[model samples]
Target: MLRNIVLLLLLCLIYSLEASDSDKCVTVNVNNLNDLVLKTFRPKPCMTVNINGSGKMEILSSDKFKTPLSNTPLAQVRITGGTFSIDPNFFKQYRHSLDVVTLENNNIPKLGYHVFQDLILRQLELRSNNILFLSNPFYNCSIYNLDLKHNKIDHLSDITFSYTRLFHVNLANNSISIIEPHSFPDTVITIQLSHNLLSSIGQNIFSNLFNLVLLCLAHNRLEYINFEKSDLGKLEDLDLSFNSINNLNQAGFSSLRNLKRLNLRNNHIKSISATNLQTSKLKILDISFNFFINFPHASLPESLNVIYVFGNPWNCKCLFDIEDSFSGNVVSNTMDCKLSQIVNAPICISYGGLCVDDRNNTLINAFSKEVSLYSNDCRDLLQNVIFDYEH
Candidate 1:
């Protein structure tokens, strides 16, 4: 009876060990699983699954991830809600067709370098985040649009967008102070660098962009713009308003012959030379809120249809000439110097016959009325009278 009882206890212990082994080594057949939501999961070989995020899902399949079983990739992974921290090569083995990628409101500290190097993305939007550095995150991808607005980018290097073929790029409302001249890709057509702390534009800053159409450098601390022999042949509109530009050199705009609209408002320009508006194709010109004491009549091109010259301290001496030149024209009212003069003694509507003060008027009128009397025989008569008086 004692031997039989000891044999029964040994058999029971063997049965318990076999049950534990079978529980630890269960095969997770992933091929039949679709839209899976596991509270906690681990995967073995010969499996295919699709993950969907709900509240909190813990995945402990890091070792089995990114590894093929029998000529078949792992699984399609999709995380919709909740924060996800995916490490490098997380889903590299699977054919990733990341149609829409967004990490909005997810406070990621540092995005790993070369994380999504070989992935094909349709749209990669990381807007409204705490991303400070805007480096080459999409190194070799062909994304349609890249939106990095409302970030804390301080410096942008030239090689930042070197490899990506992005159609639209938005870098608005950042702390970007230094953009190391010509620091954009060749595929960029529309770019917004406004509302930043840029002080000056270096020469040849837009050297490589031959297809750039719209460039907004407004509302910055720019002093002057230096366009150095760039083939901006396709550039049509330019904005350089709300800055401290004193003088525009002739070479600064020699290439913008095709520009239609040019904004130089709210600047410190005293006078503009004839070489400034040499662009014959310019239709609208704004030189308002400036220190121009006179409308640059000598520099005003005949092709201009609209010109804004208000809010300047224009002297009355120069207005008479401009009014006289534009007396009977269809484009005279657009040239305004009303804000220069006081309200009561506003800019003289009519050219009062060549603007000259009373003193200048007296001298010019005296010269005009005085007759030049020619005296051919007066010299001989004066000599004869002198001879009679001496005798």
Candidate 2:
């Protein structure tokens, strides 16, 4: 009778490991289960399955799951550090019931095809997997937020993210160099492709993203961007900082009707006409750390609130001209730096660019001699450009 009692306790332990229940969910945790121990693992109406990829977790075969997982109403599953392949038939039951799937830290070098297709997941995070390729993985899924950061994906086919409705996507910090046109879904609101190797954008690449609000192409190898071609109508923020952009035209940003912030700091821009930035709703413009001989400050749009021009080779005559231009106009937040006449961004001048504030004290502060940012002549400007800012 004592021998029978020990066998009963062992059976209960295996049952709890394969199937357990709380106030809301029945769960199956495969923390440690071999094929021998798993044959006894009959699942019961479980809502969550946590496969931690620990202790001899091999490729998960649906036939080994004993009962048909094809009918299980799972709501959430976190499969981490596993050498598992996401087979479509394996998650046949979770097509409509799954809410979230997190598959990070798996050290996966490749994601098998047909990933999360036709799944109505609220959130899906496949970050830090060391993945090297992707195609139309989320083909027909209704994902709300998708995060695929820190991968080696280089090319995006036109149908890569062509799902039903994706709200936000972060493909930042990848080796993406080629993106085909219409690669992004129109349902997306925010898309981040920063820190990539993109040198050019395909025609009509972002023209279809009518609902896109924020598009980040920062830290790339783009030499020129013709905003008149894409004309992102609903975009609010544009970050083209840290590139090789050289010039702009009058039709550069004219169609960006709802754009508010433009970050062009740390580029190769020389001069900017006020009409080039004549968007109807622009507020802040950061053209700091560039090569500018002059800025069209006299004709700045009334819709603009602030323009940051730090770390540029502004000619001394232009600095005096800006001071003279704003004195009569409706702009005087600081006595020296008239560009920062906007109330919130008062200390706009820093890392002095132009030389000679009409007093020859070119190496002191930001705007004026008392609150200066390095004012000097051509000799001082050339020395500073070579020594300080020409990274």
Task: Say which candidate scores most in lDDT.
Answer: 2
Give me the overall lDDT of model 2: 0.64
Tell me the number of clashing residue pairs for each predicted model: 3, 8
TM-score of 2: 0.70
lDDT of each: 0.55, 0.64
> Which residue runs does candidate 1 get wrong by more than 4 Å?
1-96, 105-112, 115-123, 297-303, 316-391
Candidate 1 per-residue lDDT, tens place, 199-267, comes to 877667777888776666666678766775766765666767666777776335647767666777666
Tell me model 1's lDDT, rounded to 2 decimals.
Answer: 0.55
The runs of at least 3 residues in candidate 2 whose Cα sits more than 4 Å from the true structure, single-residue gaps closed, are 1-72, 323-391
